[model samples]
Target: MSDTQPPRVDAEASTTADSANAPRPPRLGGLPLVGSTLSIARDPFGFLETARETGDVVAYDAYGTESALVFDPEVVESVLVSRADAFRKGEFETDFGELIAPSGVAFTEGERWRRQRQLLQSSFTPARIRSYAEVMVDEAATLVDGWDDGETISLREELSRYSLRVLARSLFDLPLEDDRTATVIRAANAVNRYASPRRLAIGGLLPSWFPDRVEREYEDAMADLETLVADLVAQRRAADATGDDLLSLLARAEYPDGSRLAPEAVRDQLITFLFAGHETTATTLTVACWLLGGDDAVRAELERELAAVCGDRDPTVGKLGDLAYTEAVVREALRLYPPATGVYREPTSDVVLGGYRVPAGTTLQLSVYGIQRDERWWNEPATFRPERWLASGTGTEDGGWTLEDDSDRPEYAYFPFGGGPRHCLGMRFAMTELQLALATIVRRVEFDPVADALEPSLGVTIDPGPAAVRVRPRREK
Candidate 1:
């Protein structure tokens, strides 16, 4: 499976075909004027689950615009992979593009996106990622050491700061100054709060001139973010862009035509990484800890695996392959609580999805959240079972557990970082970071969840709202 191409599905014809005569999808009943806007904002998980029950492809009105929520893996493949060019970013992307990374790889299309991806790909390669393992382990250790035994802490806040620290050191070659750390945290939270489904819907309905509190905070955050980025860029430039960090690489990299990213373009890419890189990984770590806290058996097995592979020493890049159980834990957590809840696309023209004709410009919300948890694909959809991702070793020298070949399920069924050419550039970086961080932290401290239940909020990423855990130091054997 090439990184640029998405996995092909068996039902390619029906998914990619433009069937003009195909009937419109079954409508998901909603309110008269506001349609499903209020319902979706109030309970996106429930609303999407209801949409799933309606059909593989269900239609509904959001405000005045008609939208489709796609559940079938084949249809998702068509939109994200096979006939991807037939679709563009959904309506929300317009908001993101203007406010976030307008010229960055995330929002750019066609040639510009490709060029930026090419330049950025070098920093995320497996070899390059491995080089950052020590930093990841060291940071995780620092984070764990900060917790007093029996102290309760908010996993989201602690992990978010840890992720930001790692990103700054590993990629930017900039140490997060103590005074600026709070600014980064506030800015990140402001952007995420503004991106909530409810706020987005309200912002869309209201006029641009409307003085909304959320948008106001977001704009102020962006201003602070701009200042932060300018300082970092200036620091890097003064050092002559000679470091091995991502910022240095982008500064010194050039296109085939001998052109380099302008200063503003570099800033855009920096912001893209800051917003996209830190939050998603932080949420994932938080959820992984939450899941581990509730499942003693699974957590014990994970700790055992860490002890066997990593021993008394910290996790290293070379031992990552042997930490199969640790990796599976991460995989299971992602399946249950994917940070990227859904992907949105709009058709460039009329297209058939599961035999339903969707009109041009109709927003298609690929339900990653619903599909990953669908009972049809998973045996026990709501359960946290890391064993599902492991297989008895076939060819390893030690015959230890290895990652299961995912032939039993659809390729898109467990895409935590999305798929196709637009798949996350930092997939390897993120996995390496999570696996190392989880192993490093778990080996030293045991977590007992303080929160009763995870109330997943639909934010920029799926937020495990207000979840806390009590940390107890593990007595050395």
Candidate 2:
């Protein structure tokens, strides 16, 4: 009934036209309600199959609304970067607005997001992130010490806990031994559970509605998170500390006009960093280890590079870039299994994309997962290959892979951390953390896959399921 709604077509006329001229899109192959959901649950890669059948762009009607799905890199770039203002964070993000009400940079828009971004920029600068490398290496050492030789363990969980500790220490300057660590972890897990597909779908359908159980759980988790963050702020306030830790920096950060962040704002920023910073890095590290476990030659090459550069000294801020192989492995892992499976944006105005008229107000789903593995850009797209990144001639002369030749490619072809002015602020810090963790693990131990294949579970982030890998301390030559 709204003026912005797409023109409705009579069913009979639409069907007649479809039957006469157009190819029908891929339909749900299984039982009605279970079809697409079941496919997505079973294999994350099947979405691409559906896309192939449906053309580069498809529309899905879910939860009483229509949304467009785009897989072409150019279309993706158009939606994410080229005409970004026309779009805001779409359903996927808005669904959790209530849960992350005071969301710092993650959920804000326009002036608020811009101002907050400015305030936090210096905190994640290359110099600052480099300064934190020792902290990451030290934490990694503790994790290595904790592992028992020849043990088959779930590396995902171990890395998750380890990254959580490092983020707490390096970013907030909080001691890992702080009692609040457990509470923060619990709250993070609760948020993850509440952000599951079922919950997200429901939230998308009814933004203002909150189920009683979910509401209660979210409130409880928020309370715990609030207490932890409030305590940290109070501790910083009392000490008047001006240190390199993210918390200290935030505590001291002032606007251009000379106003400090309010307590609520600070709390939201902390929550954003706490969740966003650790989860993705942990997942990347876990997947990287799994990938390395399967490839003996790559693993040995990584070890050789690390030994040549580090020489028994822990990786320091100055030496992180020296671990080129380690950096490539991390980049390849991200390309293969990005932490955020998709990015969503809403068009501000009517625009033409990929020769199709995309009207304003449509929610666009940019499948980063699909774009990364698109065969056009990558040779042997499904296989794990780090060498492509190391080879100079692999990409085009313009500094992208062959898949990026079309004007549409660069804007959309590769967006692991996103692109444009709104690109991820913590990218530098994340790269440092990942490099340190990978170097430390590969240097101290060797891992072997326990199974023939590791299944990926699509969650808030892409997760490798129940990865049990055999580990042994490296035998010195």
lDDT of 1 at 394: 33
- Candidate 1: tens digits of C-alpha lDDT, residues 1-477: 112222332334644354555677888778888888888888887887788887788899975688988888878887889878778886656556777878888888878888999888878878888888888999999999899989999999899999989998898877897667667778878877887778867876898787789978988988998898888787777889887678887666555467978777788898899878898888889989889889887887887777777777998999989888888889888888888888888987777777777888897878888898998789899999988888754323332567884697888777788778898899999999999999998888888888689888875479877678898987554
lDDT of 2 at 250: 69
Give the candidate number with the greatest lDDT. 1
lDDT of 2 at 78: 61
Model 2, 1-477: lDDT tens digits are 112223322222232223333332223344344334444444546655575556566655444434566767766666666667667885656666556655578888888888999878867777777777888988898888988988998887788788988888877888756457677667766776677655555454455654556757867987988887877788897889667667887676556578877766778888888888877888899999999999987777777777777887777767765566677788889999998877777766555555445555666667888778878777898888777666445422222222113343354666889876778888888988998889888888888788888887675567676578988998675
Clashes in candidate 1: how many? Answer: 0
Candidates' TM-scores? 0.93, 0.83
For candidate 1, the TM-score is 0.93
